[model samples]
Target: MSSFPQIPQTIADEQQLDDWLTTPSSELIEFVRTLSGDLLVLGAGGKMGPSLAVRAKRAIDAAGSPASVIAVSRFSDTTSRQWLDDRGVVTHAADLLDRNAVEAIPDAANVLYMVGTKFGTSQNPAFTWAINTVASSQVMQRFAGSRFVALSTGNVYPFVPVASGGATEDGPIGPVGEYANAALGRERVFQYFSTCNGTPVTLMRLNYAVDLRYGVLTDIGLRVFSGEPVDLRNGYLNCIWQGDANDAIIRALGTAESPHCLLNLTGQETLSVRAIANEFARLLERPVQFTGEETESALLSNSAKCCDLLGAPQISTETMIRWTADWLRQKGRLLNKPTHFEVRDGKF
Candidate 1:
């Protein structure tokens, strides 16, 4: 494995966070240059969208391209809107479910669809279906002419044996719970529209994109640091750095096909929850607790095709573990969003 720049031990302020968010690689710059016209990111208020939008804008600027990066979301929290605005990413506030609102979004030659719901699925499965399935239909209808890279979850795939090195893009679509099923619907809707209108589409099945604020690594690190018991049932998993995910999402624009392309985008390694907790304990000098036993199968993905298409992730799991531990120990800012990656039943 080639070494990448290590994340700083401590991030002092929001400015540092912004710097980390927008930094791009040479590949990203070349990818952004290839994209012409405006770049629209739907569902830009989510955990990954803000940084991704900023990264796109920065990449376009670096490449000296004329394309503008526009982020569309409800912007219920003005903080996120301000964050994107400060970074020169144009922000649009609108409910994606609203047909008029979605149609009103400026036309773009390239788009990254990030709209989807995971939490509150049990209590309100209808809304989950609407957001994941219905909204996807709306976005596809609205952006039928644009080159699209839709973000789908790896939850669409069934659990596989740890020794399998995770499920590939051709894995069966047997989602475990309501949320997972709806995610499958989301992909189907996009596929349907792509086929109907002959629009180019790329369905990116992302597993876990880790960062200090919110991810499987941070979730486990914080649990270990807090001395809480980490569940081990879903022991093996895959993760990629949020920055790497963002870059791959952008680069997927070029890989879009008329009948739609499906690709798994995640880390190559199949990580163990038990081992991750121990790594966290080692880094933070804290006691770690574990409950339950490792299961034979777990939600995992094989991103070989994506890595072959795009490049391998720069940030390694070791770097992420150390960064997460130092961030927790130093009391860095947190998004307070729990990934709930340990949920074996896929409740969330």
Candidate 2:
């Protein structure tokens, strides 16, 4: 693997953070050299997509490849579209649900499927299912021959004992809530098409990906910094730095298989909400408050297979905690999107 940029003691501003997040590692640049054609990122307007798309563009450029990075999304947030356009990534405004629009997308040898709805599942279950399942079917059919790395959620697996080190890829799946079931349906659709069309795919089951802006860490840090009582009901979780997650997802393109490879993408350690909040209290020099008790089980995933395959994430959990604490102390910009990870009822 190529050497990564040195981890900063503190990320000074959004510009610095974005630059860090989009910096492609040497391994990624090397992978892009072997990639055949342009890279298409569907649903590129979401929280993680812009950075991922930009990172791919950087990697391709660093590799001196002619492949272009194309991003497709509804782009309800015009700023996201503008951000991609400014970064030398090709931006396309389209609704994944519209079969005609999906068909109109430019062809690519590699596709990263990031389209799915999760936050408003309780209020609009049908829409969640449509975005997760229907949109997946449309994209799978439209790009039947492309090597795909589809984003999936760890929620597809039922909550396992914290001591179990999370659910493995081969374990039985028992999604608890409506959103999770729909997420599973999305995976099934990918599998079905992959079986029929022999499309190579890798389904990445990711839990919380912390970006210092919005993530499990930011959620907990905000609560601690604001003197709000931290909820510990759904105690433990698995998370990866958004940049590391993006790196793994991009690299996994090579591991795509006709049968559809299933890999859990996350940090190795099972993190504790209580411990994290207490650390935040110390960092912020504030008293910690808490409510509820830690549960024996939480939604988690074991990424041993992914680590063995892609090499372990370059960022460490300790570094994420320190960086998150500093970001909160500086009153950094937040997406204001709460992870709601404490909800155990399967509701978003």
Candidate 3:
């Protein structure tokens, strides 16, 4: 593997940001070199999927591996599909909900399952269930013979005391609200299918993944930049840099097991919203506003296991805050998708 690129003091533009996000680390390249077959990334049009797919492709290319990277999504946004194509990732337009469409998907030796609905759960919960549960069932059935690293959410685990350092993988799970329950259902579906078919699977429970464009840090930094009050109800959270998270996700193919291997994927720290907002204020030269008091518990996860298995995230939370502030200072593009990290009811 070549020498890793130096982390930029500040990302200057979207192209730079994309290039940074999709650059594979030495470890990831090593893993891809030994990867036996084609890598299929389902739901590759979402916020994190494009970068993950591109990163995998870069790794495969860097390692001079023969494996191909195929990204599947509905392609509702043609630009995302085109972006993947431009990056040398094969694109397939398909809705996983349609069994026929899934049936037509090319078979692969490994799969990164990224399909799930989260944002509109309150407004159209049935669709959320269909996408999270039904779609998961369909994909699991289709890819039963392939190894899977399916994306689950930290939301599946109920709120824990902020001082507990987040919930561990073997901890009790009590999913709240429709979206959480459905996410858990997706995991259950993977487990059921894996057990029935003897497929190796890894369920990655990720909390917040911060990219310069959108994330917990961006949400807070944007609020501070705009002079809006950052809510403190859900006081603490955990996040990993999206690049590191993507690397870890790709490397997790090694952790797949017969029934299912559950891993919480995030940074090790239990970050405080108030502290992060104040730091953003300092970096952005803006006065941060605040609303509500810190809660005793929040949706957080313990990723020590992930760090131990795949190595810790290269970027730190402090670095993420700084990058987010700098990105906002330069008027970097925002995805306009709020994480709603403050939501206690879990409606979304």
Candidate 4:
């Protein structure tokens, strides 16, 4: 057993997903193609989980064979599971804090470690560390043979000076501050796991994966659509569409490189909040309004590593906003449920 750790899956529509599969970037398809044998997707029931699972199923099926895809989650969303099963995906449930569940996962060559906590998750810092930091290490220990890819946030970077371009991977990340506990503790936990076990861990430092649920799109789009004013900060927002994000994760599989890798998951362009809002308004065919107030910090990060190492490409910002806004028009809401990680600072 590695350690104690941790599904609701709801499928929106099969045809909708089918159309999404045809998307130009094909990020998800590319990622899963490199994976073979058993595939285990952590946090498989979450927002990105279902889409990623389906893409994996497609990748495995097209090659004229069967591959076991275990989608792990604590809460099993029957609808989501059924969707995956219809497309040929298996389901597993466990707590990451539990050593037994981690060990119980069928041995696989790839482990997509998507499990994580949020900005103000659990008032108890202990719970955050236990789940985000400690349990993550145990997972790496348990799946040493597997090429591991886990989602990290841009919040790990320290304050950068204004007028600087987006950060490259080489820039020093300051301690996690102004949010929950220090990011140093969380960062160290993963750093230790990667260094000690030689797990081939790829830490993906994602800026903002554009989603209807409280991401870059929802953060600025809603106010624009509702004819409300927005407060602009000097911070630049680097966003990637969630579908592209799902694809990027799959690409991390089969990365048979020496030493652990760190890649920034972000859009190629770093635009200000006001700039994004203006673009969103243009897409929605509405007039843009904004009050410019430069917030001290910018969350810009570079995606050169992903593009260079894995050919992970980003969707254009205008396209991302259009997709999100269209979905909102159809669904009449940003998220079916509230997201806990919703950011108020407009920093990504």
How far is 182's C-alpha from truth in model 2 (Å)? 0.3
Question: In candidate 2, which residue pairs clash?
Answer: none
Ranking 1 against 4 by TM-score, winner: 1
Q: Taking the tens digit of each residue's C-alpha lDDT, what string does model 3 give over 1-348?
A: 122588888888999999989999998998887789999999999999999999999999999998999999999999999999998999999999999999999999999999988998999999999998899899988888899999999998989998999999999998989999999999999999999999999999999999999999999999999999999999899998999999999999999999899999999898999999999999988898999999789998999888888888888787888889989998988999999999989898
lDDT of 4 at 79: 78
Model number with the top lDDT: 2
Off by over 4 Å in 2: none
Candidate 2 vs. true structure, TM-score: 0.99
Task: Write down the TM-score of every candidate.
Answer: 0.97, 0.99, 0.98, 0.83
Question: lDDT for each of the candidates?
Answer: 0.88, 0.93, 0.92, 0.65
lDDT of 1 at 339: 83
Output the better candidate (2/4) by TM-score: 2
Query: What RMSD does each model have against the real structure?
Result: 1.6, 0.9, 1.3, 6.6
Off by over 4 Å in 3: 1-3
Q: What local lDDT score does residue 40 receive in model 1, on the 0 to 100 scale?
A: 95
Question: Residue 259 in candidate 4 has what lDDT?
Answer: 65
RMSD of 3: 1.3
Instruction: Tell me model 3's lDDT, rounded to 2 decimals.
Output: 0.92
Worst 10 residues of 1 by lDDT: 1-10
lDDT of 3 at 242: 93
| Model 2, span 1-348: residue lDDT tens | 125877888888999999989999999999999999999999899999999999999999999999999999999999999999999999999998898998999999999999999999999999999999999999998999899999999999988999999999999899999999999999999999999999999999998999999999999989999989999999999999999999999999999999999999999999999999988898889999999999789999999999999988888888888899999988899999999989999898
Worst 10 residues of 2 by lDDT: 1-10
